[model samples]
Target: MNLSNSLDKIKTFKKVGQVADNLGMETYVVGGFVRDILLKRPCKDLDFVCIGDGIKLAKAVADALEGKPQISIFKNFGTAMIKMDEWELEFVGARKESYQNHSRKPKVEAGTLAEDQERRDFTINALGIGLNANNFGELLDPYDGVKDLKRKIIRTPTDPDITFSDDPLRMMRAIRFAAQLKFDIEANTFDGIINNAHRMSIISGERTIVELNKIIMTDKPSYGFKLLFVSGLLKEFFPEMVALQGVDSVGDKSHKDNFYHTLQVLDNVASRSDSLWLRWAAIMHDIAKPPTKRFNQKVGWTFHGHEDKGARMVPGIFRRLKLPMDERMKYVQKLVKLHLRPIALVNDKVTDAAVRRLLFEAGDDVDDLMQLCRADVTSKNNNKVKRFLANFDKVELKLQEVEEKDQVRNFQPPVTGDEIMAIFGLKPSRVVGDLKEEIKEAILEGHIQNNKNEALELMYKLAAKKGIVNNPDK
Candidate 1:
């Protein structure tokens, strides 16, 4: 089970051993680097734990490198970092951690390698690769982490309750790993996370979002989200998403589980693109459905105006999650607002005018919107899904054709409001606004070409309707 070849990848590991020997320290590459090495997964971040002064050992290794790598030292934390080719290598002294019941931050004391490993969240991550002069390139596995890795399992190195209660964020990290690696959480560990789910309140919103985003970026984000839901962790921070879980039945009518449907959409989008925001749009496309859901005798179920409502909720949700409130937030909001537009087009006539308005509203995000809509069509009936997909293909083709003809993917109205005001000999008023709307509608409706001359002529005709006279000279 020796990773003899894996050792060859770390050229500086031997140098680290020599340096640690010079400083009379015990050091090992620990945490994710060790875990990933065992899993044969590529990792660009390395964490080194030293039983003695890690900073001194770091400096010695820096001097031993061929070019004498620059060491960035953090005195307070007794940590140092060196950026190797394509890898960020970090050095920290072995320390035992004792956490207060109320805070995730632990009181740190310099300790042995065993103590450092004891504080780790998972057994696999607690594995270490020895870099001591006596045992360079040797792996030290106290928890049988290699066996757990082979089984594709995630289990805490220590007591699950104690480990997770100490730092509830690790609970999230555990689920994230399960999703990212497609590993099953060990029985006791999974139950502990569910039992101690309420303890996540101590974790900050920003930190929670970071772990959540990592889960979302995984191959099957729904795997992580389902774990989050089952563990009750999602309800602690993101109740809105959790609220989208069940179906409401009235009379003989029921709605599909929007929660699982949304996750399917997210997975579909993940398969197509790695754009984080686009996947986010998939997650949020029906966020308001629960609040807007209704059952009627006439209609089976209706989430009327849910798209617009979901869009409005984006900023508030982003704020609570401590996600970016800038353009990214706006992008997600725009997608949510328009998530149903493409479907509506698919359901009805694929008019050039309708597609043009969609293109104008979606702008650079038109393609992403279409993708979200395609994923949104999740039906248990295969034929129903196929029919919707066929219609969607038609809508996409129509959109493409319209875009090629009119160049209105993000097209602006050829006539500006200022031009409207000047031509009508009017101030910026309702009359002016009315004319502008008419001109834009005409362009979108395909009644006239999207050119300044045609718009101006139309504008004049509309001005006559408004009883405004254009100055002949001007």
Candidate 2:
């Protein structure tokens, strides 16, 4: 397992080795960097664990670099970091940690390299590449991390229960790594996660969401989400999503399970685009189905107005999960509200007016919205899925045509309220607003062309009806 050639290729490794030798302290590149190296994955950040003062080694390495990169030292944690060009080097003292019953934060004490590796969350992550002069390029696998890597399994360095109980966030990391690497979680480790699922309550929402976002950003995010759902980790942080689970039957009629449907939509979106927010829209598009669900003998099952309800639910969910309250949140809300519009227009006799309205409402997000709608077609009926997809292609063509002709996506009226006020020689009043809405509705409805001349003429006619003067100059 000697990575002597690999170590030689990285000049910084030699520089750090030289610095550590000068300082007379043993150092090794540890954790993710080591794991990724063996996995042949591209990784830039290096975590070095030194048997002596990590801060001192970090300062020495920084000083030895070209720019004398600024070393950021954390005295409380016995760690330091430096950014060398695009590379981030984090240095930490070799230490063992003991966690309390209520907190994930562990009490740290200086220890050997083995102790540092023992504290790692996963065996695959505990692998290390020695950088000390004597053991340079040597591989340390005290936990048989190489075997876990070879088997493509996610397992903790020690007892699964103790590993997870110490930091419940590791449970989320386990699922994330499994999903990202396409690896299987060991049976005992999976059981340990289920047993310690409730312990995640001790983790803060902020910390939990970091892992959640990573899971969402993976190639097939739904895999991680399904893991989270089965492990009961999702219920701990997002009960709203949990509520979307299962289906109720009445008189031999039942709706598809919204939870699994959501996951399918998420996977579909993942296959099409890598936008995290788009995937989020898929997850949330049907979230209010539970509350809005109804069963009628004639209608079977209906989630009336769930879109509006789901849109309303987004803000609260974002607030609860500590997600961004900015435009990203607004984007998800907007998509949820309009998720049904494109589908509704997919039938025969689809009109340009409807496409124009969708274009106007969806604006720059029209493409993403269309992607989501296509992804939403998760029916088991192959013919139905084919029909919906063909219809969506038509819808997309209609959108393109309407956008090119009418130019109504995110349309502001050819005439503004202020322009209307000026044309009619009026102050700020309801009449002005009425006139602006009229022109916008006219363009979106295909009643009038999207042009200033057509809009001006219509404005003049409306002004006359309102008994306002059409004075160009007062």
Candidate 3:
């Protein structure tokens, strides 16, 4: 198939072809750029593979362009890059690679176009469009990548075992692509992933998390996660998640599989919000259920305090996964801790003080926390789900009302610690902290308005009760 018409539309492709022709080099726009073009997906990065010195081709192409864009060359990797007008073009020599069992890094050497294509992670990514004048825009598909694209399948270009064993990160990439493109992994290719799951230990946490985050960002992340679990890849890196899988029973009592429930929550959150950290919250909301599981004769099974435990577990998990240890991690942790709070409000009579407390604790993340709580209502009973959601709506309304009146979303006590110290002639001691806490609790409990006047009045009254007279030196 000829993509000459499509190639002609992209100015860079034409210029690159001309330059390659002039230099008597065989070059083709290969990998993801070619695949995305056929799929009509928006792609900003382009990879070009040539049979000879790719750096030289990139330099010549850069000189031929309108702005003569600066070329960034990597001498060790034998690749070069040029950035122009939202496009990132990377040039690499077509090469074959052989890996050692201990590492994913391959010994690289120049080879023909076929050799390079064979080394690609998947068939669709191996597709290439000719960038030499003689065969400009010609489609090269030795592995029938177009057919696989139509079939909606993820398959390696060569033997799946050899491919995955060479670079175990491809296992994650396979699952990620299937999730992103809504495709199925071919049986043999999937089997290969399962066979080489242990090899994932060789891959770094950073690389694995990149693929994991991509999967999480997909429209239905559960699909990728299920694949990861079934392929045994998850156990290699994240045994905590795998532990959430099974359901235990004492007589007729049993609990839902927290693993699948977490996935449902993840997908529900994905459908509502595109926030990656919020989705991470969903993934972690029930993460400690296994460790916290208990079976009581009265209640079937209870994962009491799982949310709190899960929150505590977040930092350690983030450290293990090489995820950011900043506010983002804290955000996820906070959500995990508070996920059950909104549901508790839904179950009980919604009160102003309850709503105010939620707003006060959740602060700026109250809305996101509400979204997570809504996603967590994954009851199999339709009526139960409806009832819970309707109650949630009422709870949200109450939250809005309380927040509007009290202005306590990110509430700071109207009475400051310094003020308490000055008033009571005390140092920065527990007494000052106690006064601040009391004032905050009064605001949240609706005993006093969240303003200086009421807080100051109550502070004085409480201080009088404690026999702490106000300083009169002034």
Error (Å) of candidate 1 at residue 239 is 0.5
Where model 2 places Cα greater than 4 Å from the true spot, the runs are: 470-473
Global CA lDDT of candidate 1, please?
0.88
Candidate 2 C-alpha lDDT tens digits along 381-413: 999999989988988887887788878888799
Residue 358 CA error for candidate 3 (Å)?
0.9
- Candidate achieving the largest lDDT: 3
Q: Please, what are the lDDT tens digits per residue for candidate 1 over residues 404-431? A: 8998877777888888777656777887
| Model 2 local distance difference test score | 0.91
Error of 2 at 223 (Å): 1.5
lDDT of each: 0.88, 0.91, 0.93
Off by over 4 Å in 1: 1-4, 347-350, 418-434, 463-474
**Estimated TM-score for each candidate:** 0.94, 0.96, 0.96
- Rank order by TM-score, top first? 3, 2, 1
Using TM-score as the measure, name the better of candidate 2 and candidate 3.
Answer: 3
Give me the displacement of residue 204 in model 3, in angstroms.
0.6
Give the clash count for each candidate.
0, 0, 0
lDDT of 3: 0.93
